[model samples]
Target: MLSLRTRGKSGIYYIRGSVSLNRQTIDVKEFSTGTSDKDAASHVMAQYQMQLHNELLFGPTAKVADVTFSPEM
Candidate 1:
């Protein structure tokens, strides 16, 4: 159950949602800046994706991995 919302004033996107995998809860929180609702949604989605990749070690994220893909690739 992922949820996305925009801040009332700053119009920043926020993702304070949860995901269940194998009975495990992965609660993610992320934020981004934008004006329109669509932009805010996209911002949250992008932030969440970055979090997943970096923290959860998804793929080609920011970490010291034994193997990594080329940045250009």
Candidate 2:
């Protein structure tokens, strides 16, 4: 599950979490939302979570296949 935390005296909010896939635990820690507002941070956290979920559900994302490469002499 995802969590929010503050570093020391800093009021900035960050996201930390872990997801288990294929018997391996991937820890996503200290992801900065760049804001002190909890609402904003929650929005950012949701985006990150969706990204992670897509990667896990569909495997690694590949974009190079969409690009055309030209041969160099």
Candidate 3:
């Protein structure tokens, strides 16, 4: 699971969480979303989570296209 939080006084949103694979838990260090907007931060968090999931499922050499986050029209 992943969550978003603001750090320091910059108000920049960060992504932090852990993933469980093969009965082992791996920690995902806090990553800066580089945005102050909550919505944008959520998008970033989703993309990162997806990437982690794919890497765990398909190995690190898996060739996957970049994930983009866009609001539905």
Candidate 4:
């Protein structure tokens, strides 16, 4: 699950969620979206969620491999 919240009167939205990997769940406390606008923060959150999902499915190294090299070549 993911959620957005403001902290310390900063008015900036932050992302908080948990990621499940290898049957273990890890809590992501807070990541700053660096924006005060909710729409922009939601966009940032969506992008970040996709990134986390990719990392979960393909592992961190797959991103580098997909960009730099192809095994089927």
The TM-score between candidate 1 and the true structure equals 0.46
User: What lDDT tens digits, residue by residue, belong to model 3 across residues 1-70?
Assistant: 8899999887999988887668656588899999999999999999888777767777756434554578
User: Which candidate would rank higher by lDDT, 2 or 4?
Assistant: 4
Give candidate 3 regions above 4 Å deviation.
22-24, 63-73
For model 2, what is the alpha-carbon lDDT of residue 5?
88
* Candidate 4 C-alpha lDDT tens digits along 3-66: 8998767699999998776775647789999999999999998887766766778887756754
Ranking by lDDT: 3, 4, 2, 1
Best lDDT goes to which candidate? Answer: 3
* Candidate 2 deviant stretches above 4 angstroms: 8-10, 21-24, 62-73
The TM-score measured for candidate 3 stands at: 0.76
> Would you estimate the TM-scores of all the predictions?
0.46, 0.70, 0.76, 0.73
Least accurate 10 contiguous residues by lDDT in model 3: 59-68
Model 2 steric clash pairs: none
Per-residue lDDT tens digits for candidate 2, residues 1-73, read: 7888876576889899876667656589678899988899899988777666656655655233334788998
CA shift of 58, model 3, Å:
0.5
